[model samples]
Target: MKKYRKVSREFSKHTINALRYLVKKKIISQMLGVIAVGKESRIFLALSPNGEKLALKIYQIENPSFKQHVRYILGDYRFRKLGSTWWKIVTLWCSKEYRNMVRAYRAGIPIPKPIIFKENILVMEFIGENYTPAPLLKEKLPQNLEKAYDNIIKIIYNLYHKAELIHGDLSEYNILNFNEKLYVIDWSSAVNIYAPNARELLFRDIKNISIFFSKNGVKIKPVESVFREIVGESISQ
Candidate 1:
């Protein structure tokens, strides 16, 4: 509890307001603890009044390099203009993640289910068991690298073909491995597959996955070949 307060102190009044809104909406009855912290957001483990576990992600807008965050927002048609100030940008960023998760989840892609969003905060289904968050794929290597790699490729294919989206930051760092099932998290960086830079982003995502699995001794296909297969394009070479 003391540690959570110490961390909450870093949040702005805007962030506090968002959390209060979640409680007011009955999305979460109380916050349990900080589950994870990243460069742009801090995730909290919370519970609904009915005892359902939820994950609350609060976006931090006070970062100096917030301008760099615009890259992901500008390309997406859903949020063409990234608001005026850093705070607004961060708020819209929160909403973007929620919407992206909804689209992917609806398409049957394995992603954290978004519950709600207010300002710079987003509530979603917690991805873990017994209040214990799942470890990132980067945190621990899977027992079967081949199976993990195949699952990841299938996820990429579904995200593109079915969801019509490209995970701009797909890598081991953003994927969670629970009971050998892969759940791709962090939809904030995803862009529409039809976006101008979607091809590049898709290629980079495939490259990151291929490199990670190759390093782990998985006999994966070439990145370009994988990209071509996913996008259904003929490779020049």
Candidate 2:
């Protein structure tokens, strides 16, 4: 929690900028609640003037040591050639996540739809209902194993083939099990299948996912098979 505050402070300038942009753009006004203070972002549950609820993610670019943070985030291929202004890189990185989320949502990948993205703030569809956060997959394992396994496999296939993306941080931590349906969040680490390190990222995602599901009582294959299927041998791991 303290870490989140420390990071959020980095976005002071960006947040102020986004707020000005949002208000100027006539986006949102009412405040409902705060969802979570994640390691890298602060999430808020807000209400619009018309009384519709929404989720907003505020990204932090400070912490001093965040210079190398890009190595860990997903979909970095888009802004690799951009000059090395740390704030610019970080801001672009957040924007990249928003774009990926929009793509995923369009491909029916069960990701939150991006409402708006400006500077470091991203507004998205709130995944929860009734003022509660949709439970993380870690906290909400399914009672029916076969059905859940099939759902997991289908989503992985969709994200891998149909969406042409690999969710690099696809552990239970990033999956929301809402009302018995699975929704993926935290796309900051998602990457295109053709990224230079795509195979490596895909393999790690598979390992993280399989390990998490197995611990939750669903057995899955090794990362190699997933890599072969998703990345193909010609991609060069």
Candidate 2 TM-score to native: 0.86
What would the per-residue lDDT of candidate 2 be over residues 1-237, giving only the tens digit for each residue? Answer: 233344334447667667666756767665454688886678877666566778888776664544655664534557556536766766776787898898788889987778988887889888888899899888988677557766766776788888887777777888888888888898877788777666777777777777777776776766677667655663353
lDDT of 1 by residue, 71-146 (tens): 7777677998768888887888888888999999999998888888899888898989998999999997889889
Q: Count clashes in each candidate, considering only residues at least 3 apart in sequence or on different chains.
A: 0, 1
List candidate 2 segments past 4 Å from native.
Answer: 1-11, 72-77, 232-237
lDDT of 2: 0.73
Residue 119 shift from truth in candidate 1, angstroms? 0.6
User: Which candidate ranks first by TM-score, i.e. highest?
Assistant: 1
Q: By how many angstroms RMSD does model 2 differ from the true structure?
A: 4.4
The Cα local distance difference test for each model comes to: 0.85, 0.73
Cα error, residue 190 of model 1, in Å, equals: 0.4
Residue 219 local lDDT, model 1: 97
